[model samples]
Target: MANRRASERRPSDRRASGLSSRRPSIDPWRLVPMDKTVHIGGSDDFNVLFIGAGNIMFGSDEGPWNHSFRFEHKLGRRLKVVALIDPAIERATAVLQKKCDSFVVSAYQDTRVFKTLEDFVKNMAPKDRPRAVIVGSPPMFRGSLAPGRDIEMQILKFFPGVAMFIEKPIATGPKSEIQDAFTIAKTIQDSKTICSVGYMLRYLKATQMMKHIIDENNLTVMATIARYACAYESIAKPDWWDKSKSAGPIVEQGTHFCDLSRYFGGEVDMSTVNAHSLEWDENAGALSKMAVDESKIAPENRIPRVTSATWKYDSGAVGSFTHVVSLQGTNYSCELEVYADGYMLKLVDPYVQPTLYIRKPGDDNEQMVRFPDDDPFFSEVSNLIDIIEDIEEDPEAAQILSSYEDAVRTYELTWAIREASERSREAAKLKAAAAA
Candidate 1:
């Protein structure tokens, strides 16, 4: 039924893109089948060409930034990584050379993918041909330092032969830019070139737990609060994380909250929003040496060390988001609180060993705690690889993952919040002038 709904709603242009290749028999229940010596799903297996080599999109500092690497690691020789990045970073380039079986360092922001493909296709090398390209760039950036049109053009060009394992908060811009990215992503949705976004939190252990809870209890989402914190300081952010380049804090950082909001409450159209900031950070940076505290967080993402916002979803659910560099909070933390029928589910610290505290009549004193973990990041990456495997086997299974279109919804939401915040500031200035 989910697949049918997706197929019925997809555009005619999108339906025409993927391949209906000869199948080699695999369990349809399992989306993408990876390499496992132990008997399980099916005997069939395949490879994929991944194009992202960024931090959150793939994995973290340890390498294999996100699930794509896990996919490759799990499938062994069957899964291939194709790396792409702003600069040919040693890690990405080295991984491509040694780790990923076949990789490309081409810039999706500058190079024309379609034109290059035409030339590459004309080449006489037998081994040069790739199975399918997975676009991991475009999204998963802190800013828009690069060009969007170029990226969109590249994705559109490669739509026919590529399956995308994109990141969440699909775009980083205002309404216009977000809309443009949406149109471009929409232009390429075919069966073979499956579209999937990195809303990895959707696969969280707590989230999975909540899915059952919500269904079993028949809870209508009344109030949902998804909070994520990046209290670290950085020396320099990626060029894209720069607000001027990326459109500001909301689009870049606040997007996780947006994605999580959508996950918990379904398609949310922000009904009301209020956003503000505590300090003009660059001023604080220049004016005070005291700003240099022990908070030696990642520098690049220092656009807003402290930020907060609130909104109401179309599903009649209210929510709030707070991002602060407070020394009090943990290094990286996320929590979601859902209120239904006076019973509350507070899920805290995800992408790790998650802890769930149920608030009800017989609850255990209603306390807040953290989720401990060992290699939690690996699980997120593994899930994404599973999605990628599904796309490779049967194009139909590919639709199960988050789509760029869905991601754009949150991007637009952030854009609106930023604009609203700015407008409120302007209104305050006008009122002050009038009194003066």
Candidate 2:
């Protein structure tokens, strides 16, 4: 996780510290273009590795963001992809050969594809080991490389303090699974690993600008509200509907807002949160003794289609989060709003076509700010490269937002909300049985 302010710096000192006055000088109409060519680098360039070879890496961008594609567009030949590890060696090789083109393969030649991470790490010389790693594997496979060891722990075993960039929804559902993630998070903190999670939205220029405004104005945030409602018709996989594999929409898709809430509102108290869920039913649309089959889904992933939850942050700020995946067609919405002293901010669609809206408190009029070349996915890779360069210069030069330890708390908040809904459903079932 990230600590934005030092302990010695009081909240009241923020406005006077001059840090808030340094606002981002970004033009709304400026179009930032991604470079098509990779900059050539010498043999002593930074070496990196990729742990997964699926859609997030090789597939086409569904909307406007794809991790591997963005990295290639930005970093190019400046870095070397020393190895790519996946269970299916053929798939990994195909992804590289087909998706990467000849130029990329030529720029990074020592890319030895391996069937497993164990094989790659064992075979490579200590000097040849990667200085950084990108983990794009699915949530269920997160902690499964070994029997009980989590992905972070396993990686730390071989390479302590390695710069790691892990994908989000840090872990799958179930309280025990969350606890496992929590343990690993603590371990990561203890080891002081240079790590960052794939909460790429936080890397958006628009988000940074909003944070700047909040700090500059010394606004006392009252509440942060977030909503994510999307149509599932375009989703290609059935397991996405099956709660077991995908962790439903909340953990799978809507986690961005949950993390944003913590970003603006500060740390949360699990005991101060409560949630309620709604599902479709036949008779009077009333909840039944068993309206849904919990067995059909994994215990960790049995999230409802619609959920509303509220929590109180340690800073005395109140927050709310809502998620829905029942819409049809191509309509979808994902955004977060902050109600602070004198001004309110609305950050819209950080994944693609990000924009920010600022309004005077109690006023209806709002001003829209947009960026043509705001590539958050690319920005995230750029940050990683910066960390790599920092480490190359000095091992302690790396500082990042959205680190793995920070992301685990977001995962915990989602799990707590799901658990609260589960408890409510069970109580309804008991009441129904008593009436019968």
TM-score of each: 0.70, 0.83
- lDDT (C-alpha) at residue 189 in model 1: 56
| Top-lDDT structure, candidate number | 2
The superposed Cα distance between candidate 1 and the true structure at residue 57, in angstroms, equals 6.7
- Which sections of candidate 2 miss by over 4 Å? 1-43, 107-109, 143-149, 280-303, 361-364, 391-399
* Clashing pairs for predicted structure model 2, backbone only: 1-406, 173-300, 174-300
- Candidate 1 per-residue lDDT, tens place, 1-436, comes to 4566644754433323211211111122232223322222443433344454555444555332455545544554443332234343554554444332434222111111222323434542443334445555545332232454344355446445555556656665446555566665556554345555666555454555565565555556667786766543332344433555555656766676666766666555564888765444444433222224324434433355455777776655676776554333235677788776547888876654568877654664775444343233344444444564453564433233355666667677777677666666568779989999
Q: Give residue 151's error in model 2 in angstroms.
A: 2.3
How far is 221's C-alpha from truth in model 2 (Å)?
1.2
Each model's lDDT: 0.52, 0.70
lDDT score, candidate 1, position 418: 72
Give the alpha carbon lDDT tens digit for every residue of 334-357 in model 2. Answer: 889988767889988766678899
The candidate scoring highest on TM-score is 2
